[model samples]
Target chain A: MMLAQDTREPFFRPEWVSRNADRIVEQLIEHAYLTSIAVGVGSLIAIPVGVYAYRHRRAYVPVTWLAGFLYTIPSLALFAFLTTYTGLTTLTAEIGLVSYTLLILIRNVVAGLEGVPRDTREAARAMGYTPRQLLWRVELPLAFPVIMAGIRVATVTIIGLVTVTSLIGKGGLGKFILQGIQRFFSTPIVVGAVLSVLLAILADVLLLGLQRALTPWARSRPRPEGAR
Target chain B: MSVVSEALAWLSDPVNWSGTAGIPNRVFEHVRISTVTVLAAAMIAVPVGLLIGHTGKGRFVVVTLSNVGRAIPSFAILGLALPVAIKLNLGLGFWPTFIALFALAIPPILTNTYVGVAGVDPDLVEAARGMGMADREILRRLEVRLAAPVIMVGLRTASVEVVATATLAALVAGGGLGRFIIDGFAVRDDARILGGAILVAALAICTELFMGGVEKLARPRTSTA
Candidate 1:
């Protein structure tokens, strides 16, 4: 039960922030570090699988469904399950985080590849482009926007999930949240929550910018008036 | 005991299935919370999404709101909700968890519904208008029928997400299968953690399968035209 006298400290005290700036920066860096590694490793696994699945029509549904099923498992459960085998290590957290990103990454990669027009493929072939050459020079460039969009979504989602990693004692900003909850201290909870949200939004905007830079052709095309 | 064997032993124990902290009761609480949250979210999101999509107005707002909602972490929302619950003397567990999960479920539903309705072929809508079909009638008979598959996909995604995240409710002192994992962590009991995780994973898989079936049923094979 909570105290009736409202004895809780204010969520954002200047003195606390000044004193804990180093710890705050450390947690922020740790949060970004974990998220980036998970997303990086997830994309490494997902991209080749996505490419193969896209090429093989028969394998697409089964592969995606499996990924989707994996995604359905709760993050906490996955973390706990992994901890049983891996113990309370970063490996457990990374495995759980990476699994969650696969579905989003694969689906987006496939969708991006599929969005390439038949005429474009035919034209590339007519120009004597091999499969590898076409994939590199034509298909991939066109698929950039969609693939980037997927990465953006996956990155943001993973950022959120990393907070749950604190449960396993590997959580960056999440440690503060857990600590706050255990002690009923509003300051750490508020700071952690705010920082996590800020990181998500910041990552999203950065990815959006990257998408625009990569897909310059998408922006160059003038839209028909009132089409939107 | 080996981790796997110990986990199985814990799961097989009949005593774990018949108390206030029993598996069955926890499962019930999880499902009930998820259902209520999803239903409440649908009620709020679907109608507003339909209005925006059908009228072709506020598309930017809907899209922006969905993006913002998605960007906000569920854990952060739960943390944010806790203080409010405590200050109001509304208890620390159920309501906070429920509200946070409810927030989590809304974005997918709202965005999907908006996209589905908005993506309905303009030709079909024009034809209905040409035939003097009322706007409401066109929305019901044509737009919604065609959009059924997308709406169902949204519902399926939201339901699965809510059910999975509801496990976090136990962290807030709410009742659910998460209790096992939380308690196990507190006590350094690997078997209990594994047992709880197994239950959560199983429940999530079942929810996905059930929602997948409903999504298939909602898919329309032939056009009403």
Candidate 2:
């Protein structure tokens, strides 16, 4: 109904959704899978780097600068450039997606850990806690909310970036978007765009739930408004 | 390594420097669209941000909108816009690309402006009021002046983003440096693709540094005043 063309295909036909339900679900799963792998790998690398940067102080600038530099590269450009070497593999897609998450993940991890109150660490140390114990018990728990905030942002960002991967022949939901653009079909475009937005919202909400459930003691505190 | 060398060779080739599809023309197209999009977004966002920041009303809505806006992917916006553009007979490339990039650029400027302006010390506003200054005077002389740095941060963020995203304009038949990448892929020319990527990345970095310099300049002047 949204189209003015002679064919007049409805913007979102229920029959089309029913007929192509398998494809839609498959793309959704692919989108979610790519996002998780990127964020998961990104977090594994970022947390240790963040901890090191937090301790060394000198490492902070270089790590963040590298990440920011990578982030400034256009997603299309990165993916296109990578295709020459990596081919159309998911590895190519994951590398680009993971690179995008590094800035958000590392910055949040450092900020969250640093945000721990100084006096709390002092009090723990006064109680005969070891440096390791103080970090594990006193600092990380307090930093959990902030770290989780970074993860949520990274997750959402990766979901969006995954769409660009379709251009290189490896996107999940983005495949549909590219197909829609090429064919000039409203049904697929609407389906793809709507589902992608919904997926982002769903991921965000799920992470918020996880954040709240994990931090029972911090429940009384207000949530941070817009982590970035 | 050969990719890098070949890409450099492609960039350094004098033949690639002329014509409508040349490096200069593509860079011009890229900069033109990005500048217009950022400027258009600012014209709308800055005033609305000023109102929200100064009045202390609609803070929650604007913040929530920015949060949602951040989550929406640029490609999705472009995909959605393409159909509407076609339906409206707005042609293919530039209009859809502009609409998408414009949407992408607004949130940072609006949020930054609001945060910068709203964060001005209320006590300063009160003092300005005591001096018989109107709300407009207080906003222009005091709040906006203090908030300039934050607003610039927003502009810098938005500018860098716009420049980076403008590359996608090529995908929709629009002319830009992105044409090299898209066209490179079409003809399987790795050198041209990498060369184009380098150009786009370099442009984005220059925008970041330039805006940062502007931000620094804006900062010291206000403090000295």
- Per-model tally of clashing residue pairs: 0, 1
Per-residue lDDT tens digits of candidate 2, residues A128-191?
A: 9998898788888898999999999999888889998998887888888888777777678778
What lDDT does candidate 1 reach at residue B141?
Answer: 93
Clashing pairs in 1: none
On residues A1-228, what C-alpha lDDT tens digit does candidate 1 reach at each position?
A: 233325454655667668888999999999999999999999999888989999998999999989987888999999999999998999999999999999999999999999888889999999999999999999888888888889998999999999999999888888888777776666788888888889999998999998898788799996577542
The CAPRI classification for model 2 reads as medium
Q: lDDT of candidate 1 vs native? A: 0.87
Q: What is the C-alpha RMSD of each candidate to the true structure, in Å?
A: 3.2, 3.3
Off by over 4 Å in 2: A1-10, A220-228, B220-225
TM-score versus the correct structure, for each prediction: 0.90, 0.93
